[model samples]
Target: MSIRAVDLFCGAGGLTYGLQEAGIDVRAGFDIESECRHPYTENNSDVDFVEGDLSDDVSNAEIEEYLSAGEDDYTLIAGCAPCQPYSTMSNGNKNRTEDHEKWGLMDEFAEIVADIQPDLVTMENVPQVQKHDPYDDFCRRLAEAGYHISDRVVDCPNYGVPQQRKRMVLLASKHGRIELQDPTHDPDEVTVESEFSKHNFCELEAGETSDDDFLHNARGLSDTNKKRIRHSQPGGTWKDWPEELLLKCHKKDSGRKYIAPYGRMEWNKPAPTITTQFYNYGSGRFGHPEEDRAISVREGATLQTFPSDYSFVQSEEELSVKSVGKLIGNAVPVRLAEAIGQSLIQHIRNEDPQTQLQTV
Candidate 1:
């Protein structure tokens, strides 16, 4: 029998699409955002989408009704709970006790697994999560529940993602111990220049995309910013900026430490981790290697390992660059997810049904 899966917090179906690519039967996806419905359904036509708040309790009835669309196959429940609360990037808001609701969602995910007793479970999140109490508690609870688990923090470039994103992945099974797939490619093998060339994207100027693809078109820059980028060198920081073009903040002692913003990406290196505002040159090291504009939406998606045809918007009216950037940046890289799926399949195939049933 084929393994079947459901993705919780399934933003734009990155994990779902990837598991499907690895031959897992992904029957449904659940997320709080309604915007996810179209992209998740459109890309995986056979998959159902359920929208609801993950911060609240997800009852057994709701899980069975909305997510359990498959039959008596080996079941997998996968989720990447929102990482913003645990992310170092959002540490400024660390004191906000009320907003910790997002962190509580992971406990809810654990509760669901305890109730449903799925054959397998998986979770992906920022590496910083391991330092906190919640992550440690989740692991302890799962171990106590009789699940054999393995987890490690991994660099995305090792898994064939063309960006320098590091994440912690957990793979647990009631049947037996399982671990994620090893690196398929070294960091140098999947550099930005090499990956772009593979997809037919050559050197581009301001606001230009390949003639064959409009999605590759970059966000246009203002005259001042265009001049700033022209002076910026690939892999260079804000110090390279002319005195007049430099921001007053960059002149301050504290600001000199923060050079990632308004920096240009190197063609020969993996891109800096793609973020929700990646289309804006002012956000992190998102500037094009040589072009006088930020990386395009399609470029961000490609770096996230999303396929060429993965649709983010339906029409021009719906195409807000910031909104699309958030969806792509927040996704688990598709290639990394595929590697996890393949490992899970191997683990399941190796298990003896008689021994697996004893865990339940």
Candidate 2:
């Protein structure tokens, strides 16, 4: 049997690319962000990119058309519904009710699964999502549809991603029981230093861009921020800065507990979680371990396990650090997605030995 897939909420084709790498014929990707079209199409040339909002009237018939387009014998519907409402960062927010609008998106995904009833289904999201009712409802719907479901919190570094991102992964199959693969990497062995050593990064100063690779550009920093980064030690926080260089917020009693900001990643350790603001010097521990600047767009993408040559934009002019950063930060780490693909393939092979799997 041949396996085919369609990625919902596919951002920059990260999940789609990984699935293709593991031998699944990803026929198309559906996402609301029109900006994602270029990267998604450019990187995964064989897959179609459909721009549409899944939460609205993007019909299940259109999705079914894509999944059934090819001659594949097996089909998979994979998605990571917008996770902001269930994100840990949104806890205790004043405007959380406004964020709840996105909570219904999982219901939209579940409805697609229940209606289409694909051979397999999978989802990835922040670990905090499981504590919420939407996640529970999604699982309940899957079980009711007669799918065998398994889900767990995954340590990204254990799956060969060189960052400290923990995500909740789910695998459900109409075939039989399914689960993610065992960890392929030792956390300590996949450090920032080891991963960076694999890439030949052009030495760039704050506000510099490499002519060779536009995505390798670094964000500019203010003079004071430059001084702060220069004083920062690997694995150390703002507490290591001199009192004169401290920000007004850091000088206050309430700010003393916020130490991860204005810090540098430890060379021998995995990096802090990559956020949409990772290009900013004061956002988490995003400073380069030795360089006096925050990590570049390429560096951030690298930490997210996007291949070094993965292009986020078609040309230099199309690049927007803020826009691309969100896409990268929000992406499922490629290696983790590959692991998920591997596990699904193994499950299929185990359930039916006659299936022939192929890799790109």
Candidate 3:
């Protein structure tokens, strides 16, 4: 029999893909977004899906129903709550305390775990979740319920994702103690050319792309920003841009502290942290290495470690990709998920040699 699991707050199934790749049978997903339903269901047909709020009538009821069903030792529940409250780059429009309180949602997750008492429990979130009260409470409660919990903040690129993102992850089980997976790649890391080169990888041509392709959209840059990027060679700062193109923000004394974003990406180093709005050159250090245009949505997804065809399904044709890219940008990279899956598989195998993970 396969190891069965559920993915909560599942976006476009990036985490699901990784779990599946690591040989766990993800049986279902729960999310409130409509866009997720199409690609998620299409990509993950073997798994049933529940649409709506994680705490709403349908999601909770369906969870209970599955736990109460005839099967036992076949349940694995994983969740990732909203990270907006912990995000460093919000627009400052939403009420932080009121609108983005998903730290408390861990309570809801704990409640379901307490009720269902599934054999395995897991969650992934931003590193900031550890500082909040709710996660601490949730961990305490899960331990009391006899689930041994192991938590850590892992750097994703170290596991072969090619991006630098850190996330807090948890793995718990009713059996014995569990540990996280070890790194597949060294912390020293690979270079940009190593990650996105067209030599071994596929091409990311215009209007079409694969997640593994070196994706770039090649949009026309504004005349001024264009000149700025043209002179902004690898590893150089805004000083590379002619004096005429310097922004007022760069002119301020305080701006000196923010030079990381105004410069070109270093050819020999990992790129800066990729954000959801990475297509906007102003959002982060997302300018092309040599091209005048800011990165296209495809380019942003590459930074997120998404394979070219992980479809986002949008209406604006151009902006539609942004939604998918944002989700990809915000995702726990599939490679990281695969590492987590590998650790959990080892834990299970240590207990029961009969349990098989198709992939190690």
The most accurate candidate by TM-score is 2
Cα lDDT tens digits, model 3, 1-360, are 446778888887777777877887787887777767765777654877678877765555677565443343456788787777665554245466446656566788888888778888888887877876777898999999999899998877688765557788899999799988777887566555556672343332223334443234444456676667777877677877777888888899988667656466665676776777776666667765655556566656666666656666633343464566567666667777778777777788887888644441
Cα lDDT tens digits, model 2, 1-360, are 567889999988889888888888888899999888988999885888888888675889999998774465789999899888888787768489345788888999999999999999999999988988889999999999999999999889999888888999999999998989899988889989988989999889999998888988888999999999998999998877889999898879999899989899989999999998899888899999998889999999998888999988888888788999999988888989999999899999998887676644
Candidate ordering by TM-score (highest first): 2, 1, 3
| Prediction 3 global C-alpha lDDT | 0.70
Task: Please count the clashing residue pairs in each candidate, in the order shown.
Answer: 0, 0, 5
Q: Tell how far residue 201 is off in model 2, in angstroms.
A: 0.2
Which regions of candidate 2 fall more than 4 Å away from where they truly are?
A: 69-72, 97-99, 358-360
Clash pairs (backbone) in predicted model 2 = none
Two-way TM-score contest, 2 vs 3, winner: 2
lDDT of 2: 0.89
Judged by TM-score relative to the true structure, which candidate is superior, 1 or 3? 1
Name the weakest run of 10 consecutive residues (lDDT summed) in model 2: 91-100
lDDT score, candidate 2, position 348: 93
Residue 271 lDDT (model 3):
71
